[model samples]
Target: MTLKKGIVYALLIASVVACSEKNGTEHPDTATPVATVIESEKLKFTIDTLTDKLDNPWGMAFLPDGRILVTEKKGEIRIIKDGKLLDEKIENVPAVYDHGQGGLLDIALHPDYTTNGWIYLSYAKPGEGGGGTTIARTKLNGNAFIEFKELFSAQPFVDSEVHFGSRIVFDGKGHIFFSSGERGTKENAQNLGNHLGKVLRLNEDGTVPTDNPFVNKAGAKPEIWSYGHRNPQGLVYNITTGELWDVEHGPKGGDELNKVEAGKNYGWPVITYGINYDGTPITDITKKDGMEQPVWYWVPSIATCGMAQVISDIYPNWKNNFLVGALAQTHISRVEVDNGKYVKHERLLEKVGRVRMVKQGPDGYIYIATQSPGMIVKIVPAN
Candidate 1:
């Protein structure tokens, strides 16, 4: 009996050796497995390029049929279908200002898109004298935008083309929220009289909601939801909590993430952690009694551009987390929030190019839009 047991043990040791040696041998039929490097100790995913020919694509939305609509900064909307960029640009898009930081920007679909076919866009539009951020609603009908109407535009358009804080999002409660930058003028952020540097909430057809905080205030723009923002390019609505969140660019440092609430002052130039671009001090304070503070602020800024929340069943680890697109640092920031408070964050997809937008598709895959050699990449489980 002892001899039999010894033979069994010897065979078990030999089997282990054979498995370990397999790594050193070349198996021609077995393809080399792709390796994944962990980042920030929180995110583990693989980026697969869906298309790389986009020209500085700024934003993208997935169609129900699995195609994608991408907006190029040069005032064109390109479609990606069947893993190939379509030859023709979508027709009847608004004429974009297309200068400086202004141009074709964010895009979103209605929550009932499967039934209503409503598509919303935010862009820099040519106004009477200069240009400003504008929101337009249109219907997508066979490669063209039909029945398009300008839904909202920032008041007193500025001639300068920079700092168009244009991002569009919808809360489930029958309202739309959009942001507008101060157009390189910091004082406009503090003034309640102008729509610049403020987030505006509107009904689907451009009318200001009566419930807006500034609606009853004399001399204030009734559409104003929250004010005192810088160049905010990222806005998203958290469906689970029914709250809106946004990220904005800072001067030299102090990029910020704020939980947007109605009728609140975000304290831009008056209270900031950033210095001017010329290395001058913008403010001596970072806090005050009447102003709202950011949930998180990044010193030595990353120049964050776009944001999206991950609520995918496929990525259980990343569920309910927010993904921020870092343009200057060329990475995606995974931020975790606990009970509406910022808990922790980590950077992901470092050096993949300037991440212009990060979105979660309806099919549970995270999509990233990169600038420079513009491309759309999808993130999935490394498997």
Candidate 2:
């Protein structure tokens, strides 16, 4: 999967395609394009390797000064400044669990970061029972963290290592949204008493918002924005439409892309298009009365992870589409949707190493973080 310098890829739109639908039905009309190289003057891009020095890079955040902050799964925060990866890691990062699928996971800057200088992080925090997902914030001061504060920690830390559904996004309204996996416990997704397996919303200072759906519901965690999620690793807030979207991993199959709304129940174990990893049926039903269906799902699991929407016009043909990282298949899933409805799909950068995260840089270009070789690459117009 060594990507040569200045390699170009094409974007082709076919009228007929095939894709997996929410009801476990294969849409007869939609087909996922694979290695379809049709040279186009309109939609072409080249991959430029930024740096190949990272270690298991999990998430990335761009600074106003054109620097990049990347988090490695093993608890280091590295910086990419002036087009080169700095040798120094940020100092004073909090201790993370740093075990299977745990560590410093995602990084984000405050909406008012220019004035407040606040940076937020989601990591697996080690505690009494075991390790669980945690969110914290701090201000950066010359390669060191200052005014560091723990914002929230998912309760009842379990001993499991996998399924830490942690990604962070802001709504530009003084609130933060993050995901938490069920800690390998399927039933936890359905339980509201614990923070596991839910999308949480809180104020910038870690206070539960009063208008949250379950604020008054006894026995429910007040920070919960939505419940019944499996392991949502990819989350994004559409500032234009004011919608929150998440993509979570499913077992053997059934990776889901959901339109997350307040208080909605996204069935995980109770109803799934997936089965046990060893090929046993988790359940016979894929739909139930109260549970919501995904906008789209992937059979044979792409291991969907960190995602970003194409909001910038730099890539005119990709405007408003979603670029999602596929770890298992090692490609970027370019998904197109219209008004929350699934429209089409394309597979880009096939065999591109384990694509861990895809983000739109503040400069209106697409940047991708990948593992195996452990590098960051930028996509720009081939023209």
Best by lDDT: 2
Task: Per model, state how many residue pairs clash.
Answer: 0, 6
Per-residue lDDT tens digits for candidate 2, residues 1-383, read 12233222222342111123335443322113233333333366655666765799999989998889999999899988877788788999999998898889999999899999999999999999889999999999988999999989999898889999899999999999999999999999999999999999999999999999999999999999999899999999999899999999999999999999999999988999999999999999999998999999999899999899999989888898889999898888988889889988888877666888999988999998988647787876767
Output the number of the TM-score-best candidate.
Answer: 2
Q: What is the lDDT, from 0 to 100, of the residue 62 in candidate 2?
A: 93
In candidate 1, stretches whose alpha carbon ends up further than 4 angstroms from where it belongs are 1-40
lDDT of 1 by residue, 23-130 (tens): 345322111223343434644555455565678898788889988899998899999887667788899999998888889999899888898999999999987878
User: Residue 320 error for model 1, in Å?
Assistant: 1.8
Question: CA shift at 101, candidate 2, in angstroms?
Answer: 0.4
Minimal lDDT window, size 10, model 2: 10-19
Model 1 pairs in collision: none
For model 2, what is the error of residue 137's alpha carbon versus the real structure, in angstroms, after optimal superposition?
0.5
Cα TM-score per model: 0.89, 0.90
Candidate 1 steric clashes: 0
User: Each candidate: what lDDT?
Assistant: 0.82, 0.86
